[model samples]
Target: MFISGVHHIQLTAPPGCEPDARAFYIGLLGLDEIPKPRSLQDRGGVWFRTGNCDLHISPRENDTPPGTNWHVALRVKNAEALRRKLQEAGARIDPAPEIPGWKRFFGYDPFGNKLEFLEIA
Candidate 1:
């Protein structure tokens, strides 16, 4: 009865992918990386912040490949520009998006995590 919006969305990354995650989430997506607490930093993961949302990336227990349709949709100011940035970074981008109410597209990070970006109309 008292649940607020999501405090954070935690996604799994394979071990030792911080550089790749950093490149995609920060270098490409433009989210600002945050420092994990000293107690948790040794666990091997990364954190990011955008507005009020905190994104936490941890090591996957199974370390399997990412699947289609399982992705995080981020509201962006200019989705097209981000898509172009992804292309230039050599990240795998899905075909042109066809969703309503948003100019959007999907892209995968170097470690094969799915991410979606959309600009709400």
Candidate 2:
């Protein structure tokens, strides 16, 4: 089998916590919010667009699992700068070691989902 590219990556958010999700995803992460279709509007959640990739968060009946191992790694321009911003916002940042060619770290989203951001080092 052959695959071209990723369409989107989704993570679960706690129910009725869109405000926290927005604050972390849009406000801190710098990802622009995307409008959901009419069909999915009432379901409760949010979507964001980052250049060519789309990130979707859906409401879950339970809380998101907290972990540093399982996560979504995003390629970025300046990982250090973003890491600082995250620290300033009272977000949890993990001291992840250097990845071969990348400056990397881990930060947990509002719903406790782990996210990895890296830039070419």
Candidate 3:
């Protein structure tokens, strides 16, 4: 099968955690909160947009284990500035050093979801 590119990334969060998830993705990270289609609103989740791609959060029946490696990577113009912004917002920065030529850093959301910011060389 041929894949054009990533359409969107879906994250699973414990039920009733949508508000906190929205706060982090919107308030802290500054991603635009987009309305999910009426058809999907009953699914109890939220959607965020950054450029062309989408990030979705859906309700999960069980909690994900700590240290889970699942994450979504986003590209930014300045990794350092973004990292500082996140740090100032009280997000914990993962110790994974930035890979040269692909400036990037790891961070966790309010719900413990891993997020990566990368700056192209």
Candidate achieving the largest lDDT: 2
Ranking by lDDT: 2, 3, 1
Task: Write candidate 3's Cα lDDT for 54-118 as tens digits.
Answer: 99888888778346576788888888887888899899897657577898889888778898888
In model 2, which regions exceed 4 Å deviation? 66-68
Q: Candidate 1 local accuracy as lDDT?
A: 0.83
What order do candidates take by TM-score, descending?
Answer: 2, 1, 3
Better of 1 and 2 by lDDT: 2
C-alpha TM-scores of all predictions: 0.88, 0.91, 0.85
Model 3 TM-score, all chains together: 0.85
TM-score of 1: 0.88
Off by over 4 Å in 1: none
List, residue by residue over 6-27, the lDDT tens digit for candidate 1: 7888888888878988887887
Clashing pairs for predicted structure model 1, backbone only: none
**CA-only RMSD, every prediction:** 1.8, 1.5, 2.0
